[model samples]
Target: MSRPSENGLSSETLFFTATWNGDSTRCVARLAPAVEAVPVFPAYDLRAQFEIMRLAREKAGIPAPRTLWFEPDPAPLGTPFFVMERADGQVPPDVMPYTFGGWLHDASPAEQRRLQDASVGILAALHQTAFTAEELAPLGEAGLRAHVAAQRAYYAWAHGRRPIPLLERAFAWLEEHWPDEPGPDVLSWGDARIGNMMFRDFTPVAVLDWEMAAVGPRELDLSWMIFLHRFFQDITTGAGLPGLPGFMRREDVCATYRELTGYEPRDLDFYELYAALRHGIIMARVWQRRIHFGEQPMPDDPDDLVLHRATIEELLAGYEPAS
Candidate 1:
């Protein structure tokens, strides 16, 4: 096992990678210590959230990080951090190696179909598994509502400050098209996506990043995944693959989800539109953080800027007049 490297502040508090001793080899662990340094409002106590998720995973028979240790504050290690048993797999979001380019670049329709199936299957299993709402009662309905409101407010503030027309439009759309009946409440992984899961040999090995995990409408999770694909579609055409692997068509995703879970999909258009707006808002905040911290230069990616702008326009276009 690789010896533990000397621990110290190296990067942003929410995320950092470090090598640590494993049973037989050095294992690299990514740490999301807390939100102590971020400018956003605290959603939940990071330590507590991790504990809840860990317990939830065990109860549901889901493969998640086994929490080795954790603390509420920066006492033991000068920061709130948790250690978990690292699993072996590749995160789909990272840059794919050249060797992977063959299948990635020239993927047959059949192969693409398989990838989509796996993504849907994993999410279905996640939502279908049992985990009592009572266990998550600490984050009450009000708390969940506040979480969504906070996100909306944060984006609106960003839009007002920057006066991005597209963002303003997206906000308007979201307000108009909010779901009428958002289905049964379930544990929603706030940021559900293929990028968040680790896969080995094209199969999911572990689902990571439960920092934003909470109890909410089941459709919230589904919408997030569907919107993620749409977000990517906005950025590029068929010329070159982006950093993340493209899954099957969005229709296929929704169909597969319905087949696996026995719940008919609803308001896909509204949800997808909401997803795009949500993502744009989140990215805006991320950009704001980078500028506030002077961590790096403001993004210069024209594609990203346009995509966010376009998402806003799309949102506005989908807005319905109030009765």
Candidate 2:
């Protein structure tokens, strides 16, 4: 096996590529070094997240990227970094060769449907994992409430400067209709969306990006996946991807979920509303962070703004006041 490189280092290295030895053999790794200049958040603890996900994947019997090593603080690489085994495949619903553009067009309808179904199957398996109350004690009611509060605070901070009426209304609504019982918490890949999975021949080989992995309501993952599909549909339609099947329209995805878990999705409209708000908040933060970094030429597309605004409206529409 080839030895890993300990070459150049920087104060805030955001990108680096290297090869390292793993338990099995050699593997390639990429590092998204620390952003010391920017504000840090709970989810920034990538190392802790990797460990959580590593254990969750093993327990759930899911194929995921192997996390070889990680550090929480800046030290050897002048920032926190983790090495992981790279999976060979393509990110679905992406604009890459195997996804959008002419690639999806070349593929038969069945092939496209298969890929979509596989994506849903991955979520089913994730949500179906059996985790004990003792094991999930760390992520009990307090943790769930904190998570929700943090999200609300993060979005408030991001939108505080601009004060979008729709966003404020959505945030208020989310607080009002917060689930009475979010159901027994399960291991949730907080960002369980198609873009985070690798696919080969219309099948998911590995799920990636567990930075937000945590014990949460199973509906959290489901909502994230569905909302992502909606986002892709919007983007594909905007880009003129003709004949592209709606990523979340097929009932087979939901059917498979019910069959695998023996639990039909309840209050989907509520969760979908929350999902949209969550997505919009995240995106808004991304844009805000970009501005903070002096990255100009922000998205000027009115339609993009409309999509986010519409998401906020949907959240408000689904809001039911607390009794």
Highest TM-score scorer: 2
lDDT for each residue of candidate 1 in 1-323, tens digit (9 for 90 to 100)? 24333222222233334445643422333344355466433343556556665764687655676666665566655655665666666554423332134443355656556665776776677778776666676555523355567666656565455655555555566666667776666776767876667666566677766655667666667888777765655454443656334454567777898899998777766666666766776666656666668876655542243336666565555565446
Cα lDDT computed for each candidate against the true fold = 0.60, 0.63
Find the 10 residues in a row with the least total lDDT in model 1: 4-13
Predicted structure 1, TM vs. truth: 0.76
TM per model?
Answer: 0.76, 0.78
Best by lDDT: 2
By TM-score, how accurate is candidate 2? 0.78
lDDT, candidate 1, at 255: 85
Give lDDT: candidate 1, residue 181: 74
Deviation in angstroms for 60 in model 2? 0.9
